[model samples]
Target: MLAGIRQALPEAVCLVVDDNSPDGTAEMAREFARENGCEQNVWVKVREDERGLGGAIRAAMQVAIDNGFDLFCNLDADLSHDPVDLPRLVETCLSENADVVVGSRYVSGGAIVGWPWRRRVMSGMINGFTRTLLRLPVRDASGSYRCYRVERLAGLDPPRNPSDGYAFIQEVLMRLHREGARCVEVPITFTERRHGTSKLDLPEAVRSGLTVFRLLATR
Candidate 1:
């Protein structure tokens, strides 16, 4: 994943945030950086605390913001997200002056491969539920593959989101919508992971559902 990203976006400052993965993901990324003479552009941040998707993403984004970066992009390191498509997303953000550019699977030209029907149905339901209930204007608020304007992300700096899991994706999008962010969605294909177990289980999905209600009630 690190090599692919470097090859696709040589100018990008890649920040890899790992929650102390037992597989030595952080060390491998560091080694990759050193070997490629990209020590200045590739950075690895290892979290010693409890693992949380939102926390990891927030920390990484904050680092970019504090370092005076104008743009920040994040995608799954599992190769589910295509690094080659990154340029299109970034270009859309600039062309549209969007606060965030989402790589959406529900939009035109978007497709999902290798997922079972049950998983697809559940995903669609959750996306539709969050979009309607949270009043998000975008079709795919749950997508983590996105490019965000550092300035817009900065406004949420002490991180207003309460979710630490997948719910954080939708909640943050909802919050940004409330803040009047101009969001744009670009088509992207989502391919299920061919290796490794998925962290999202039945319990996690239920929790995310409950969190949606919590957000609605709090609103």
Candidate 2:
């Protein structure tokens, strides 16, 4: 994934946030940086503590903001998100002057590959439920593959946003919508992970559902 991104956007800086994986992911990222002569552009930050996916993403955003990056893209590292689609997301943000661009699986021309019927059905149902409840303009509220304009995100004070876990993605969009951030959705094919077990289990799904209610109640 790192290699693909580097090849696709050589000028973009890559930040790998490792949550102290026993598999030596951080070391591998550092090695990749050295081998590609991107040590100046690619950086790996290893978190000794176990922060969930949402936390890690927030940390990365903070780092990017601190380093003065104007835009940043976030995607799953499990190889499910195709690096080839990244340019399209970035392009949409720039071309449309959108504050946020989501790679939507439920949008027209978007499809999911390598998933069984049951999983696909469940995903569709969840997306529909969330969309109806939140009344969001987006079709895929749970998708994490997204690009954001740093200036717009900064106005929302991302560091102070309280959402964690998968709910964070929805929270971000909801907050951005309230702040009148321009959002665009780009169709993309989502593939099942080829490596590492998925962290999204029944418990996480329940939590995500509850998060929707929480957001609504608070609003």
Candidate 3:
């Protein structure tokens, strides 16, 4: 993941925010930065206090805002999202005058690889339910692979997003749509992670579904 990003977008900062995983992910990233003498652009933040998907992303967005970047792109460190598509996302955002570019799997040229029928069905069902409930404009509201215009993102204030889990994806989208952020979906092939096991369990999925309903109720 790091190597691909370095090759594709060398000038961009690779921010790896870890919730202090036992597998030493933070250590590995930091060591690589030190060894490659790329610590200036390669950053690793290990959160010792709190651990959650939304919080981690919120923290990272804060860092990007603090650094005063004009655009911010986020992808999975597990390599599920292709680094080569980074330029396309940025280009689409700039060309279309969009505030957010979603790397979508439900779009015309998008696809999901390696997931089983059950997983695919569940994902599709959740996304459908979310769209119906929240009236989110985009087709792939649940995906995390996205690029955001920093000025628009800062305007939304990610820290105020309600979800603290995977559901943050849709919640932020709903919020952005409400705030009139123009979002475009760029098709991409989403490959299943090769290394780690999936952390999303049935319980977590249920909680995320409940969160969707809560957000809709509040909306």
Candidate 4:
């Protein structure tokens, strides 16, 4: 994943937040960053609490804001999101005058690779439910592959989006849509991760569903 980022955006700064990965993933990433001569551009911030993906993203977002980056392109480190599409995503936001640009799997040219029928159903169901409940135009509400204009949404002070894990993606999308943020969809092929175990579980599914339901009910 680091290699893909380096290959795609050689000049862009990359900050990787490691949430106490027990498998030495953080160390390996640091070595790869150094070997790739991204020691200055690439950084690893380790968390001792291991809160979750959302926590890691919030931490990264803070760093981006503090460092005065105009935009942020966020993707999964597991390679589920194609890093090769990074430049296109960034360019789309700039050219379209959009505050957010999502790499959507449900768009016409988008697709999923190596996903089982059950997983596909889950993704579809979650996104479909969010669309209907929230009245959102985005096809993929739970998608994390996206680019954000840091200043556009007021830099995370927009709202207290209630989510912790994968659900945080959905929550943020909902809030953005609600806030009338202009967003564009860029189709991309999403591949299932080749490394690491799947993080989704029955409990996470329930939590995500409940979160959407809560968000909808309050609205």
User: Compared with the true structure, what per-residue lDDT tens digits does model 2 show for residues 113-164?
Assistant: 9998877877777688878887777998878999999887777754344766
lDDT tens digits, residue span 67-176, model 1: 99999999988888989899999999999999999999999999899998888888888889989999898999778999999988888635454788888888778878
**Best candidate, TM-score-wise?**
1
How many clashes in each structure? Answer: 0, 0, 0, 0
TM-score of each: 0.96, 0.95, 0.95, 0.94
True-structure Cα RMSD, model 1: 1.2
- Please give the TM-score that candidate 3 achieves against the real structure: 0.95
Where does candidate 2 stray beyond 4 Å?
158-161
User: Which one wins by TM-score: 1 or 3?
Assistant: 1
Reference-based lDDT, each prediction: 0.88, 0.85, 0.87, 0.83
Task: Quote the positional error of residue 48 for candidate 4 in Å.
Answer: 1.2
- Runs in model 4 lying further than 4 Å from the true structure: 158-161
Model 2, residue 28: C-alpha shift (Å): 0.3
Candidate 3 residue spans exceeding 4 A from truth: 157-161
Tens-digit lDDT string for candidate 4 (50-162): 67777777778777888888998899888899899999999999999998899999999999999999999987887898788878778887788999998864544544655
